[model samples]
Target chain A: MTSQTMRRRFAATTNDLLDTDPRVALTLADIGVGSFNGRNHPDRIINVGIREQLLIGATAGLALAGLRPIAHTYAPFLIERPFEQIKLDLSHQDLGAVLVSIGGSFDAAAEGRTHQAPGDVALMATLPDWTIHVPGHPDEVEAMLRRAATSDDRVYMRLAADTNTSPHPATGELAKIRTGTARGATAVAVGPMLDRVLAATEHLDINVLYAATVRPFDAATLREIAQAPEVILVEPYLEGTSAAEVSHALEDRPHRLLSIGVPNTEHRRYGTRRHHAAAHGLDVGGLRTRIEEFLR
Target chain B: MALTTAPPAVHEYEELGRLMSLMTGDEKHSAAATSTLDVIWALYDQVLRIDPTRLDDPARDRFLLSKGHGPMAYYAVLAAKGFIDLDTLTSFATYESPLGHHPDSNLVPGVEIASGSLGHGLPIAVGLAIGLRARGNPARVYVLLGDGELDEGSNHEAIAVAGRRHLDNLTAIVLDNQSASRGWPGGIQGRFSVEGWAARRVNGRNHEALTQALTTPHDGRPLAVVASTEAGQ
Candidate 1:
């Protein structure tokens, strides 16, 4: 792991937030055994146990009753199974709760496809006004945990499975890595997928952009990134022919925008996230190649 | 007009008589579905200042069936009160009836929240109450939830928040039917599991017991009435 990866880890941020505020609660759904929860305070840690519906429903209830809750669980099951409860209880009621949907995408190869939730990012992104946080590296994860605990609105932080070291943001600007320039064409990468974006920019005259917050994609930031000749959108969820929508949003500009994400198919082959990343042209080398070809 | 109670319901008895005759037999536990019988009749017959001809009036008091599946009795009361044209109790659980086995506020005109899933109505009711109170209107809100659904975490949070807010305009009625579902075990039950609800068991058929609870002035705090009943009441 790189020194940059060590910069962000959720454990410390979560511990500090739970300790500082008595109103704040950390609810741990029965996830990977021996999760580093409950160290803050047992009473502060609510183990709802294998019940995703109960976890979300109870958290909404608790929030309604004047308590702030951070409900943590695996992504695939909670995002899909109890979607109705989440939609009605949390979203419809507008009673905010922070959801930590962990083990996204290839992080599930060790378990199986059932545990992978690549689609959640796109589904969650559609909920109007909700904060969609996909931390690129561990440092961003730490910065985001602080934001999640303090922010009063609904925030869905789609955390990646990679525990590898990455640089945490020292300032609020890098804390999220909202909007930045690379070198050649503008490449906007989300989650830890920035590693691939950075790698792909080699031997090229392209610029790169990393988005920490997905929902209210800082329009100003995107406009700045669009200052470049071309732009690419990266997400873990499948992009179903909406590649044109990305281009259309920037139709006024003289740029060819391409979306890099999972395809609209049931993925016949089951393998590592890296494998899917490679086939879908999401790797650093693949992205660099795509840029070189497009720019040429 | 000020809300008042009806006395000597021999007229009510005759209506129930016709309802039972039309219901015919015990296929889906029709006779046993009397948990909200007296509560519905009480609201429809006396307390509610509403006209059957003007069911959707803006000034009318809102009655939400939190225990929506209690329609075995709700339809009977609605028919008796003329919310619908006929006492078409036979069409229950049939094709495209305004009445589903459970009430969807979206479908049924008089219904407020679609609640077959239980423990859902009160929060919405609280929302309605808060909005109405903010508007400085006298329209009161009533939500009737099953005692069994108090086990749901939603109920506890709703009650605590409403109570803390002193929402006097909202009256929450708990139908202590004892069982969450058929053959799911039954017992002496309460609502919201709060101190006031646990103080006593209610007699569902006893009009006076409900009257004492429902009519009590909430004095700025939300009111809860644990109205209990037996299967065949």
Candidate 2:
């Protein structure tokens, strides 16, 4: 629980949700890898080869017809190209379909920049009715999907890198993670890159708050946890999309919010998200070092 | 299917225009913009059998506007057929108005789907035709598509799918204004000339051509009647 090791928990939960809930359907926008097995389900799982717009629209159609549709695709195509569809067909209607997004921030490390979903968190959460949850580890992913499965609420899950650093808390809900004590100041991790933050800033009175729900924020809960005058926001995207904008928006009330993610300079760079994170010190040690200096 | 929407008795196009003028400008424009009103008048007058009072009856033939923006003409047809109050046309596109720029299936009376996007309508039309064929229900699915909307590929896919399936009960009318929005290439009939689509380009404004093509049963393949029209007509 103390270290990172939780990717499987999230996948298992999603598979279980699809298995048990008869009304739940998922459109696999041609993605077979990264957390989802794409097997086990029958014709119900629609594999639309690389058509993000149709994929999203199909999900909306299925949802309108009394199905709980979960559309999971690469983050960039999911929110960027088909943005008009998202804003109109899905988000505007508030169809209550769960948008299970994978590859937040630098998660698309090997695929390079076009694949890195640096602006998604910023773009999506700003919409009228969205609930964003960025879990720090795998256990949180499981718990988040569980909660999402039960509600008719339209949710956008910013997924973590499926292979690395899993966080499983004994008391497993997102609310529990946010309410947990900070080992130092609360370092808010927004993407699947939470383990990097934990590994980096261990010396500071470090307690990790894994807030994953993007919209329909538990504002009271956020305000309560982010009470510290010094708060740092971490996500895998750039300035507009990651936690920085969120930090600034919350600036009106209180809290000293510092935003961190892929810097503007590194946007066009080559490498995987993990490499970029490590290069820019998004990893645990890099984050740990920054906190020590910032607090000092 | 109970046919209730009887065409108003022998009203001249001039009289029909006068009946339409009773509504406000936006409503009239909305009605005017779809296809030439004559096509709609012919459908209600000579062909389709349905009670205007029972607009939502599933047994009735389904008329879908794949050219969703063409509601300009469609609204007047509904009014002329008495499917909706002629006065309700005045509230077109206002807040909460059922007559929006694009049809909202939920709000608009007799609308089958929410559409304004170019490629969306045909699929729903295909669904309707398929459903009726499957259920052994005799309802015909009529879809009006604009030529410019072929800029969207999905409409093409729908045409291909329908033809392959031999859905004799389904009819698709392509409004070949050849214009995308206010400007752009305005000759869809010109574009289709390249494929050498064994097509019939008629004066979209001409009532007889529109009606005969619309009402006549196809021996094989779905019908694509490309009618040329001026913008803002």
* Chain A superposition TM-score, candidate 2: 0.79
lDDT of 1 at B4: 46
CA-RMSD of model 2: 6.0
Which predicted model would earn the best lDDT?
1
- Best DockQ goes to which candidate? 2
Q: C-alpha displacement of A96 in model 1, angstroms?
A: 1.1
Q: Give one digit per residue, the lDDT tens place, for model 2 in A190-288.
A: 546555666666545545665455455444545556555666766666643545445644667766556666676755666755567778767777776
List fnat per candidate, in order.
Answer: 0.00, 0.00
Tell me the whole-model lDDT of each prediction, alpha carbons only.
0.63, 0.62
User: What is candidate 1's lDDT per residue for B1-233, written digit by digit as tens?
Assistant: 22542223333634764664454333454533566778877766656656656656655677877776547667676666656545456665667566666765555555545566777777656655654553455767788877666666666656665665567777887776656554223342333334233223457677766666677675766777767777444
Worst lDDT run of 10 residues, candidate 1 chain A, spans A170-179
Lowest lDDT 10-residue stretch of candidate 2 chain B? B189-198
lDDT of 1 by residue, A46-141 (tens): 555665665666566456434567777778766876676677667755777888877676566656678876678767755666777777677677
